[model samples]
Target chain A: MDFSSKLLENAVYEMSQLPGIGKRTALRLVLHLLKQPKEQTERLSNALLNLRSEIKFCENCHNISDVAVCEICANPKRDRSLVCVVEDIRDVMAIENTSQYKGLYHVLGGKISPMEGIGPQDLTIGSLVDKARKGEVKEFIFALSSTMEGDTTNFYIYKQLKGLDINTSTIARGIAVGDELEYADEVTLGRSILNRIPFEGSLKAN
Target chain B: MDFSSKLLENAVYEMSQLPGIGKRTALRLVLHLLKQPKEQTERLSNALLNLRSEIKFCENCHNISDVAVCEICANPKRDRSLVCVVEDIRDVMAIENTSQYKGLYHVLGGKISPMEGIGPQDLTIGSLVDKARKGEVKEFIFALSSTMEGDTTNFYIYKQLKGLDINTSTIARGIAVGDELEYADEVTLGRSILNRIPFEGSLKAN
Candidate 1:
């Protein structure tokens, strides 16, 4: 689209570089900022710049943090021996919100997606393997998604810890808590039946 | 949701302030930015800052521009006596894309909407009336959207130019091009039938 102002065009172009935003949506968003108070734009720009320049990742788990080590990894109450492996900090936040998992996390940064040119080396698997080889972790839970990329990453990590005396397991996949049985996908339903747990054990956990 | 880093949280909060963006989408977008090169983030922030701080509006028509007067308004080929009053720069861009009208534009900034606490004083209506009184414009085409606020704004401007010798007209309300007549809404179809133009005139315009 033809823009009257070069500044407007530049702003819209940069905004459209974002993951999901298109040119038209970027124009709408930039125009909205133009209509708002100037301070709002200043605040947004400062926040984004600060985030990029000043943000830190925890040395232990590679999760986003404000300090050298993240709060989750630094907390004494969290189980250091039981590490949950996941995709990114968003997944860390999701599990943290449940208030159920008390173990530390190892953020993989992303799954192994050859289609996207993201291989195992691009992730934090090497650090995780080092931790396991040093006998720091006792049990490693593969909490990655059930997608093909997720499975590939999990298998790659599992293979890395082949000789280590570490207990490896994956998160259970089944029908969602409030979902209908008939609505469950075929693979999930079949796996749920094959990996059926004890009735009393499920009750006790709940 | 609990964010692992304060910087991440702040960035997401500022991002979510944009229209239609929620907390989850904001997190997704922020994470995407984090995964990208830091220079990309710097470029986006700098572009937004530059646009907000240095952008100019056309003095003649109130359209966003890099100079005192926009290209359309400064061009000698455009009819200065014929002006199309619109809501904002987006409308100006849309009308310019058509290349069907050779008239100048008068951007109102926004429609007067009581629901949003927007008044005529908040718009550039006074300047338009002043132009009409100065005999600079011979006709005005209200090209605002077919909404209550658009109609109210149109009537208010029409009343302000009541005694002036300028002719006032509104854009036609009818079924969109390539849209099936059976699917057209009652009001638009009814208005189209009532204000039907001669077939020869429509054919000639095309």
Candidate 2:
């Protein structure tokens, strides 16, 4: 009933801070914890405390990693020239689960959303441009979200690479309007990646 | 894409340990963290770490509390003679939200389910019986679930208090089959409490 205790209240408050969870759900979680064995609670506490201490981000692709380079970027068998540009590491995980894309990736950090006060300077666009300037990468694939901000980011990046010889492309229009790339089933996302389209002017003459 | 850092990997692993969350969800949560300002992540971490240190269970009622006795158990205005018996602290919260039931509560820890390897001895039943034996209480309200385990627990407790003069009862059968009292809407659960029935021979000619 009335949880005036600091421990239970703090636990509920912390859990409520998570996305999609409310105060009621937080209370439910705390009560469930109270009913569980002491070992379970200890494990949860240990897991939370150890999270930041042990994990790191891949230096090359920016995906989550225990090592410096990550498994995807370190795999020499994968295609390195075709780079998939994504908004974050989550997008990289989504692409990797399907085993559909063998190429490397470039994390943009976020899309160019002016309304939200995010700009090109806030992203990793410079690194991508430098990667492109190196001339090793043959293609730069835009695997960003299908939102208005995502479109703006695509256009901005496209303009930045005006003179580059590398091919620029975006994942297909098959993904319905307003649909999130992360929420899309594996089959749909894989199909969309496989059916990518080249940018308007980037399609060079044979 | 490839994820390579230990910090990122640890964050993903911690997120995955939560109920219903998998590797993909964990990755998304970790990426979401990466996108947030460092201050927000710090606040979350602080809140989580303080969870165990800030609160504890009430010594008398077993409700979550910052003090030795929870507000409900400590309140002089509440009906001390009438104690509601429930499976967990969540049920206490559910009842408190209604602003009804001036009586106090006793958390049984859990029900008796042989299949799940839980028995009467596994719960906080001895203390409940001790409270009833004190002769200060007039009634004992069983608010356990309607499952076989709940019934088994209620029957076991009833057998233990066979000689006590206190009136023993249970929350009404108006609650639907297979419904958890914690999940029930306030109104339905409220009515069930109002329509509770006395245990047969519990208050016989004291």
Q: Candidates' DockQ values? A: 0.92, 0.34
Give the TM-score of chain A, superposed on the true chain A, for all candidates in the order listed: 0.98, 0.79
Q: Highest DockQ, which number?
A: 1
Checking candidate 1 for backbone clashes, the offending pairs are: none
**Model 1 Cα shift for residue A26 (angstroms):** 0.6
Off by over 4 Å in 1: none
- Tens digit per residue, CA lDDT, model 1, B23-111: 99998898898889999999999999999999998999999998889888899988999999999988988988988999999999999
lDDT of 1 at B179: 100
User: So what's the TM-score on candidate 2?
Assistant: 0.77
Candidate 2 lDDT by residue in tens digits, A1-206: 35666667666777777776788867766666555565555655555445555556667776656777878889999899999999876688678877778999998888998888999999889988888999989999999987889989999999998899989998765666679987888867887788766766436522
Can you tell me which runs of candidate 2 are displaced by over 4 Å? A37-56, A75-78, A172-206, B1-10, B42-46, B53-55, B173-206
For model 1, the DockQ equals 0.92
| CA error at residue A107 for candidate 2, angstroms | 0.9
Q: Give the 10-residue window scoring lowest on summed lDDT in candidate 1 chain B.
A: B197-206
